[model samples]
Target: MTLDWEPAAGRPDLLADPVAEAILKGGLTGGPEGGRKVDVAAIDPTLSDTAAFCERYGVAPEDSANCVIVAAKRGGEVRYAAVMVLAVHRADVNGVIRRHLDARKASFASQAEAVELTGMEYGGITPIGLPADWPVLVDENVTRRPFIVIGSGVRRSKLALSGEALVAVTGGQVLALTV
Candidate 1:
């Protein structure tokens, strides 16, 4: 099924504040018109989760990406990062991700922390507009996809863009982030 895709640059109404700001500011380049080619579509808020969204939208598991927030702690310091993986796979949070963050332990961030820190709803966090200091780790498999669906930083909508575009917009690091 076709989603009502529209240029993300022009659809701030469908985006959360940070998401709209990121796209409007031209992604990471910070140029006058440096936004990546992204599309947005409104969806049922109750079905915003990966499985429900994919099923209701007729999106394949491999064509949908989930962005999870990780809290890595070491030596009394805590850092947060965003991990992007296909819905079909799970992010290696305790293994590869922990090592990558140079932390003694890594796990999913608390919903309150994620929502507060990212200025996004709990179930609607996207890699885009994440804090610059936070690393965005994209699973290699995700980068190979021509297009994928991800959250719009709000439960009411979804974003669609090429995996390459996602990397460019978020300055994502491509790696074997999934197991």
Candidate 2:
């Protein structure tokens, strides 16, 4: 059976983004060659808050994985990066991630920087279809859950997938990287 996607309000252009296109075509995990269908849902852009989004969708915040990209500066060089952190455990910005990225200084990417570099809207970035070289760090806690809700490559929508499936697709490293 083919999976269908529901479009969100006021953002029909979202369907054109590479990331969203990837999700609609390949699913949250890209699926196995000819795998079971994965469902995609769109919501009002005003309901973009992580907690609220999950609540409306009947998913617990703890069961949702938030994908955040941080730009770090090391030796005066800036690097773009992404991480999959369980909503329950915030990314260890000052601890594990800072060291993992080998940044002399690390911080969340500014709204403008994130959108400009990733071509993804803020409040809606996922590691699934990111650039090939971008480092994707997955928090240990996220793997413990059966499934997670992540961005659908757009701010107005999100995709759900099995935790194991996510690891398999992204080839992401499960690390003790959360605060």
Candidate 3:
């Protein structure tokens, strides 16, 4: 489970198309060393889920984050946003999110809808390369982590970065978003 981490900016092949493009387009900066904001490692695609990936990679649940797409509806309109929380915590999607988004109802987006919208595999959706209009909500606990393992927008790989870097790249709003 020893991962050979490399700067994500240098390994575009490890990222999904939109994800690579996003990174090259201001989502990240710096070279392959100290200044790099994101890093990546290949993984078994089948172990892409948070629990399985954490177990396989020997990653602590607290050091891993899960990103889920939420479909919030207000009246006749629907909005999509990404919610990020540590693997040890569950996002407060129904309560806090519904209220924050001012939606009548809030629920996880369907698999097909998620993949189609984000252009990333359902199980590997990261907050890094979402639609420009979609908000990225990050849990306060996640932001405290010095390093975190998140999706790479593709099941076959995973990205590693600091919570602050994630927030800076996605313009994430840090909040108490756990149940």
Candidate 4:
């Protein structure tokens, strides 16, 4: 349950990814007790999706956090958020999220929109470097893991850290957000 991350520049796949670079450079805000923050582990850049990543890295699906961008609209205002949930479950986007956002409806953001808005690849958008104004919703289950593996906003690497550090980095609200 410990975080072991190497410098991103030492890995070619991660050297050019901004989000991965941000995590490696200590750009995320907030600190847990003892001043421990966050860290990144550069993996094979070709592991482009969650399933491949976990299996290749000897990580379990339940131990990896998935970041999903969701949106809703009311009165012509679209509210967007990047929600974190473990790979073992799904985000209650149409239920808990619709209620949380106070919108008439909610749905996952399109891949194109998510990539464009987050400035991260479709398979790698993470909560760490999301737009400052976007709220990060973390599933209560996700925060319970001693350590969680997450996307680094690029296909080339992953970020690994404590669950508490995740809450701190995203400034997230822990809730029963999975179905």
Which candidate number maximizes TM-score? 3
Residues 1-179, candidate 4, lDDT per residue (tens digit)? 33357533344355325564555565542223234455456677778588888777788899899999998888989989989999999999999988998989799999999988888888888887777788899999888887778887777767766787789767898888988
| Ten contiguous residues minimizing lDDT sum, candidate 3 | 26-35
Per-residue lDDT over 64-92 for candidate 2, one digit per residue giving the tens place of the 0 to 100 score: 78888888898879987888888888898
Error of 1 at 56 (Å): 0.9
lDDT measured at residue 117 in model 1 versus the true structure, 0 to 100 = 98
Global lDDT scores for all candidate models: 0.88, 0.70, 0.89, 0.76
Candidate 2 clashing pairs? none
- On a 0 to 1 TM-score scale, where does candidate 2 land against the true structure? 0.82
Error of 3 at 161 (Å): 0.5
> Candidate 1 residues 147-179, lDDT tens each?
899999999999988888888889999999877
Off by over 4 Å in 1: 27-36
Scored by lDDT, the top model is: 3
The alpha-carbon RMSD values of the candidates against the true structure, listed in the order shown, are 3.3, 4.7, 1.7, 3.6
Off by over 4 Å in 4: 1-4, 7-36
**Backbone collision count in every prediction?**
2, 0, 0, 1
